[model samples]
Target chain A: MSATRDLVGVAWTGLMARKVRTLLILLGPIIGVASMVGAVGLTESAKGALQVQLATLGTNLIIAQAGGTFGSQNPTLPGDAVRRVDSVSSVTSAAATTNLSGVISVPVQGASTYYEAFPVPVRAADDSLPSVLQVRLIDGRWLDSADRVLHLRSVVLGSGIAKQYGYLPGETRTIRLNNTNFGVVGVLGKVPLDPTLDNAAFVTQWAAQHVFDTNGKPNELYIRTKDGTTAATATVLATAINLGGPDQVSTQVPSNVLAAQAQANKTLQKVALFAGLLVLTVGGLGIANVMSISVIQRSSEIGIRRAVGHSRSKIGAQFLLESLFVGVLGGVLGALIGIAVVYLVSSLEHWVVEIGYGQIPIWMGLALLVSVIAGLYPSIRAARLEPLETLRLG
Target chain B: MSTQDPADPGPSPDPGDPTVQLPTATGLAGPAVQPLLELEGVSRVYGEEVEIYALSDVSLQIMPGEFMSIVGPSGSGKSTMLGLLGVLDLPTSGTVRIAGQDVSALDDPKRSRLRGQSIGFVFQQFHLIPHLSALGNVETALLYRDIRPRERRQRAFEALDQLGLGARADHRPVQMSGGEQQRVALARAIVTEPLMILADEPTGALDSANAAHVLEIFAGLGTPERAVVMVTHDPTVADTALRKVSMRDGRIVADERRVA
Candidate 1:
């Protein structure tokens, strides 16, 4: 093995001796690996774009309806059931979401306040939930069960609703729901959770119950799993929650919209497989060509080696090892360049581009494997060639 | 003095220029110790249908330190004989014993081991790898063997010193003259301190002056520990060797021992 490595070092010297050919050899695998990585990045971004789009889908969520006795629109899960889902094995978080139609007075300018019409989702949640639905709270704190006293009609407004409510955090404002008056507790800072649900005000389900003053029923029960258990945990919890009599709660993943995007991405992976394989094939061919030509060009050198008692395998390994190296180099460079291109293009368009760094490691490792196989073919041929004839030919 | 001795173990020389065999066959003075290399009835034929006899019915005994030259025409299979003797190519029939080991009977790896340990090679063309400097070229051959890099460096320098090339150790092959490159190649070949050096036309590409310098190096290699068997076509080149043998049509046609 050491002998082989020494030969490879020698072979690489020979390869570097011919830089133009080496560069040409690197082109195919680079483009191939780059395209594959770029496809991966684009697929990743497309999926994320949908996640931002479907942050409003609020799917990947488990919604609670009244035990099939209440039906779709009117079914309301009890408040206690919402807390039970929170403690489930895979459930990282749970929240009760209720919507209340209300009229609010917002300070317009100097003397008067305007009461513009807007309805909002009133979510009563533990603090962990702000991250679960992928919402970013730009300023102020997320709603927590610990701060129950300050919870009276306290609001965390979406970016748009925060603009209109004209009420800042710590400012007193009035809202009327069900003909009862309530005071604003805390104004929600700007956040991107559910765009459809953003215009609505957020208050405790307790406060919502007081303002709307309905019974202890909730329209939706939302739960998010801990990280790394998104799919399996979501499925099991979704299955478990659905068993609450007649599929009253159904589970959804923001990833599902992403998965649909990833289905196209699934197709992209197939294309990537073919592309990566093709890139490797082309890279291998470059290796083969360069090595075979090296054999041709170095016929006299081969003769010298054979005459000096170098085995055929040693000669062959030199050429092959050179190719393998070029392939791996090209794959690495391509992956890097591809990743850079993805990041470059994404930031240029200004969509919320999420090129997940997690996917990179596995695919790059695979590209390296392809390069080794590519380098072997021409090397064997170079090694097996009849030394006498090769030398005589020169 | 040129007449044959009856009890002489040396092969009967051809009538042409049959001089006295050397009185310096080291162990021959005492009870005969093992010869450094011995070939017996070795035959190598290529292809089954219409065989080309590369080497046939050849026998030779090389005592340690003998400067032997095998002179032959281009197709006379001198290279083949060199390959067989060096253990690079196995004889199809008959045995090749190197320092008392029947190397022909060994496995491929063992044959290579014998080639690595017992023999070194120099070729007609200077085969210094273009990428390596002269010193690096010599060191490369030792990288696979048992020698450590430091010792290899020491041995390579010593070998280059033997060829009067120690000062040119840093030069690449292209930078060196043809004679210097060939000398570097010879240094690379003999750095392993093998028992015998098999050179196929080592000075074939050099001018007579360069060739004379290489012949001197080969002559200087004559010592009880090692031997040199060179192949050449020039009679003057062959004459410089202490013992000259000629081959033709895949068989030894002349065996002559020079007085020198």
Candidate 2:
């Protein structure tokens, strides 16, 4: 008997019966939100994951003495200060290592003394290197403590290094790192981030020290502070140790690297926030306009209802309900599509995509709010129409 | 509820005894001799660039339960007068009293309510809602009341049954014959049980047979409790009314009684 119920009945009948037109009316926001959600998701994920990728060296690492520029082609982290950091912290684990590329000679059949050889990059770690920079071994054991003192020609070649020398685990092959021969002890799996590391052999500190002939402390220090000590605190501690030391060797809490990473994250998060807001604003306005226009067109139906005893508010509510239906549908669908795209992208590549700690939920909520407001304004307009005028115009 | 009750003597005295009976076709159910509606100086003005007077100073009165007809040429303001009588339109200046209440002074919503409760409308176009069935079109008058859905359908069926249209209840306007559709329209008009039925060219949309059938139904509706007012242009149709009046330029030109 109340005006609104009948209006709702009338609106519901028309909308439900005309399914395609209703969906077409809602299309603008759906497509817009989908594109916006997917793009923003991918960009933020790529930025955040980059920081983690850069910080994989697990130790409190600091470099000095201008070996190379930061985030550059040749040198961000120095290779010589690894030992100095070990002496600074009692529980410290450190190593100095450099990348080398040279051929390793192997005697071939019918060759009396000389042999054909192939070139490869080499890396030498300190005795405590395994403790400082861990390797995920595919096969064979790491170089033992005895391998450092003996100055033995023993080495651990990476998978690429093994492939270059045509060698595998338990096989005999020699690789010359900086013109020094070292026996192949093992092969590691592919670390695509550094092709140089992948192709290089792991040599002991003494062999590398004797070969390179640079006993000048390491180019950088990679130290492990005791647990419960902040990376910043450890860096502070290292700075304190280096400030008064003769070597000018600095200590850094590796956590600053993580902080640097998160700084990038913060900026990316802000960008994602802005993108989401833009989508919501535009999408909301579009939905609101469309809903309002439809309400205007249906004013005659509204008049007919009024003449039949429908109230003004009832007409308004019917329109509002239609708007709300659109909003809820767009929101849930946009979120689901956003998360699905993130998943597909992450799986096919090395990307890290997380929907929970990011703009996805916020955007979805905004979309929902937009949809609600879209319905709300039209509802009010419909409710305010005079039954008398409506009937006349109709 | 027998068709011929044994307790009710059949046309007592058969017009043979002075005090016993009346021999009129609708004897006991016939209309009382009292006016049910009165309009004094009813005028409707239409204003555009220049003000056009649609109806000016129209006055008329209809006795309760009498069959009345209003005939006029095109642009004669007959529709305007009927609109005022039905409370569908307000008089620009004048008084319209229905059942002794000055309805022109009542507020718009109250007037509308009064029309819904007391008057039924039958228009030339059949005016049945296209989406509704014949029965549904008839049932629209009961929507504003608190009657239940099943009861509403029952009453609608009863009205259509009286029009001899019980079989056409499920048909739509397009599906029914012109005669059937108009009979359905007539059924719809009387379904609300209003005090008076107003027809604006009820037979204007129908052929001769359908128009005759609609006229017969209109004639049958004249009784002691309800009255009928129909607007027409045809003399043959106007001749069917118990009383026929003529209008020209919003004023009555003639008023007369049918010879039976």
Clashes of each: 6, 16
Model 1: per-residue lDDT, tens digit, B125-239? 7777787789888876665553335656877888798788889988889899989998898887777667788887888889989988888888886667678999887777888
Tell me, by DockQ, which candidate is best. 1
Question: After superposition, which runs of candidate 2 have C-alpha atoms over 4 Å from their true positions?
Answer: A33-122, A127-135, A149-151, A157-173, A187-201, A224-231, A240-243, A249-394, B1-38, B61-67, B97-119, B128-196, B208-228, B243-245, B255-260
lDDT of 1 at A359: 60
lDDT of 1: 0.67
Tell me the deviation in Å of residue A152 in model 2.
3.5
The count of backbone overlaps in candidate 2 is 16
Q: What are the per-model C-alpha RMSD values against the true structure? A: 10.3, 9.8
True-structure RMSD for candidate 1 = 10.3
Q: DockQ for each candidate?
A: 0.20, 0.09
Error of 2 at A278 (Å): 8.7
